[model samples]
Target: GAGVSQSPSNKVTEKGKDVELRCDPISGHTALYWYRQRLGQGLEFLIYFQGNSAPDKSGLPSDRFSAERTGESVSTLTIQRTQQEDSAVYLCASSRDSYTGELFFGEGSRLTVL
Candidate 1:
């Protein structure tokens, strides 16, 4: 895809199970970010990866949540031992980062834990 694409736009999983969501960012972008939105709340930054720099995982909710990105390209988010409260929309965005703050976002991967 030319823009960011996320798999399984909607997912349903039982609590205590695990799920993996995927994302493909635009070509040539140097910055990629992951965020989680809980219901009506604003998007919360989860992690970010750029070039050869180290990833920032400070926003991860707990050990149950983790993500990875390969050089501003494809990325995956894994939620382990998911809980009902883990349900939310996972968003991915990428940008060229040439002194701009704009980030292109995917439709988002919606997960519902039952």
Candidate 2:
């Protein structure tokens, strides 16, 4: 996928387990973001990375969740000690540096904790 690519489209993990979700954005995109959506709920921003600037992680739900982006290319979202409440669709998006550009989103990785 030239737009955005995510691996392990669906995941089921035991409670207290850890999971990693990966994202590859379009080449040259300078902005990347991670969002979560629970069933029947709107997307909630988790983190944002733009260029060399420090990432904005204030939207993360807890300390157990974190994301890393390498040079605006690929990003990995890690969730530690997963719980049922952490189940959701994790969406990745990327866009050009311009503020007016539209974000290209991945199909999302669905996580289910049991």
Candidate 3:
């Protein structure tokens, strides 16, 4: 029963570059979600996928961001043309249901745009 996990824990990059963050969710969980938390702000839902159902990408910030999930297991978030405003902690969570409070979050992938 592995929990959600993320890579690099921290990332520092220059503006206008591209970055890809990875996430590994718990096994047997059909619901996965991606969220972003900027400084002094709340978590913003980016994308969510449940089983073979249609994936929800409504919360993505701009055309520069995208995500994908495979077999309800792993997910990756990509940011193209990174801006300073994109600097924040990209968090991944998964639960049995989106409305459930049992969602678990990884340590988060922290990105710094300079």
Q: lDDT of each model, Cα atoms only?
A: 0.87, 0.90, 0.87
Give the Cα error of residue 17 in candidate 2, in Å.
0.7
lDDT of 2 by residue, 1-114 (tens): 677999889999999999999999989989888999999999999988896354579999999998888776889999999999999999998888649579999999999999
**In terms of TM-score, which candidate is strongest?**
2
For model 2, where is the 10-residue window of minimal lDDT? 47-56
Model 1 Cα lDDT, one tens digit per residue, 1-114 = 788899879999999999999988888888888899999999999988785353578999999988877765788899999999889999988888735788999999999999
Query: Which of the two, 1 or 2, has more TM-score?
Result: 2
Clashes of 2: 0
Q: How far is candidate 2 from the true structure (C-alpha RMSD, Å)?
A: 1.2
TM-score of each: 0.92, 0.94, 0.91
RMSD of each: 1.5, 1.2, 1.6
Which candidate number would show the highest lDDT if scored against the true structure?
2
Clash totals for all candidate models: 0, 0, 0
